[model samples]
Target: MGWLSAGDGYEVALVEGRVAARATAGRAAGRQLKSLPKAVREHPEVDRLRRLAEWLDRHAAACVTQVDTWMVSSLPVPTGLLARVWPDEAWQSALRDLVVVGEDPQEPGFLRDATDGGELRLVNLDGETVRLSPATVTLPHPVLLPDLEDLREFAAELGVTQRVEQIHRATWLRPEGLAEKATEVREFAGGSYDSRFALAARATALGYRVSGGYASCRVRDAGRGVEASVWIGEPYWDGDTETGALSWSDENGRTLRAVEVGPVAWSEGMRMAAALHAGRTVEEGRTA
Candidate 1:
């Protein structure tokens, strides 16, 4: 049994060319990567890891994936790489496993001062004293990077670099909240692309403000890369889609911003839309 449960949050699973399942942690188990796109490499563990990275990278405006765990909040994800997600509580228990349990001005000074056992304080080249934590992170399982040396080799195989970084700080709109906003947006943009409106509306429910009008979502490669145009009210439209340009407008049907939404970025659009809806500044809501 996977982690999905009847009432658990939905996690999208892409197989061959279809929308495989809306899974939870338990339901996610045993779901093969038969449908994931070619951009994701084919090894069993690599496939799952890529999807998880893609999911978090695409859906959460700001998120981090390390070797052992994933963190998607304002808090920094301790540095470490792993093959699976770890339970949050284990962070404290496995402090010694961290790459750096260092102290920062942003962190709670009390917590930093509380730990005196095996803690190391060192000054950097800049002559800044920083207290390092003793925790270390370990991977749940070993992962393969057969193409680690050559960038093109890895990019050719994985369609993207196989590097994953721990997030130090990220802010995002909650997914459930975004679903609710989509409802309001659907009413705002009534047209043939009602589904797009719904999807965007859901994103709005999560707090993303729609800057561009709307465009048709073009699904390709059996659903590996979904493309579309969305309006993000900022200096410019954001999205690195390859399919084509998205068309959106206002009450006057004037073109606001037409952008390409890629399979990986579409998920990010949902998260970005949420941040916009919440009235967060573009710079403040960016993901690392």
Candidate 2:
């Protein structure tokens, strides 16, 4: 594999005529190609690598989109299918470290590895690593995972972030003791979408991550971070979905009291709600 300039201060390496990895120009320049001219910016090989890099990026995105779709729709995915795609770096990156359940949905575990023999390696709730050869596995939504909070903490300690939004999706049950302490910053109504995917698309366009039927964005202010999330329904393509509620949470997945929420977070949450509301479709009988 050799490094080549991919333009815009980025560099990619070609491995067997395929883009293997990419990095900033600083990292790509060294003993391989000390100068930009020697990098052969217009070489056919460099062009091929650039195209391969774009293709790989799209493939990775498609993999993540499909996996997220499966999780939201509660669809079953065959183990053999996963094993087949695991060899592909993009697909593997999207599938790895996600919470998956075997044929029996009740027994969910964290996906660690997929073997060539069509077997899956996972870490169970009891913190045990075991190999499973079920006919199929399902990537359950974060809401369906009982040990989600614990898993999130563990994942944070390991510095593992999933592109599929399993561990990073913040969730919290309304605390009874904090009921009096809690406050509502904004309540939006009449913001509805034709389907969950439509809302997710808008959220994704707005630079938020869709996870567990919600579109969430994280903001850091004055060294403190907060996540603002707006709930959309499950990923049923034809099913109607509407904004449920907007919420803010701390880094540890604890819901923040309205008073505790900063102005930046509040405004951002309202902005997201309004943006989603603007995209709401008017029913046939309703007049705009």
Candidate 3:
């Protein structure tokens, strides 16, 4: 952004997300100051720039969140929508380098650019840039990508770095032989925290919601909604608490048996459970 004149002999602008200043008539004219000068510290132009920077930060975060949701759900997004939003710097940063699957299905590519002319430029696994105008594209979850390892290797060679986690997001797979009638999985049970508040805080920090005594994640799988939860104790409790069994419930709140959970739901549920467990306090060789 171009600098704006704050007062006399000085101009101010947002630099690296903060208000910065430079002299206009002195020896240091046209050179950025190491810190904001007191003369313009409370200036209206500087305040406006600071607010704009803050708003831009929030906008960037929102873009990453929306893109992350689309990837996690493996939902198809309209190509036109991508092209429309591609002009936005925030959206572009979040969507770039994501693995996108178009009509071909078998040919997954790294999203490179989206043009206003309704074309998408992508770098395929074969290390070639290709243009496509598929009606829609899917930013597939890493677990659903058949050639995940290959894509990861290619991304490394291409020096790909995505602002939002897609290819490198943690994932867990449903194991074979879960008891048919098991309504909850105890795989991540018995994680202890200093207090219920601490456990709930960890869950929230990890981007899960706290409701009642459970830290939960709601996801749509196979056209149905399922909520995965791990017990974190009652919200009002301040005493020590232990992470409880992980479970899944339908949108209507009916518990689902292990065998009844869909693949995506199962994987997402396990991912949540594993994440909560990873934060459990470890005491020597025993879990605290």
Return the top candidate by lDDT: 3
Q: Residue 83 in candidate 1 has what lDDT?
A: 14
Model 3 lDDT-worst window of ten: 279-288
| lDDT per residue (tens digit) for residues 16-91 in model 1 | 3233434333655545433433432344544464566576444333222222232111124333321122233222
Give the C-alpha lDDT of model 2. Answer: 0.71
Candidate 2 clashing pairs, residues 3+ apart or interchain: none
Candidate 3 per-residue lDDT over residues 1-288, each given as its tens digit = 998999988899888778899999878999988988889898999889989999999999999989988888888899999999999989999999999999988899999999998899999987899998989899988888889889989989999998988888777777799888999989899987888888888889989999899999988787788999988888898888888999999999999998888877888888888888888778888745
Q: What TM-score fits each model?
A: 0.20, 0.55, 0.96
- Report model 3's TM-score to 2 decimal places: 0.96
Comparing candidate 2 with candidate 3, which one achieves the higher lDDT? 3
For lDDT, candidate 1 versus 3, the one ahead is 3
Give the Cα lDDT of each candidate.
0.31, 0.71, 0.89
Which residues of candidate 1, in runs, are more than 4 Å off? Answer: 1-70, 74-101, 106-131, 136-271, 274-288
Among these predictions, the greatest TM-score belongs to: 3
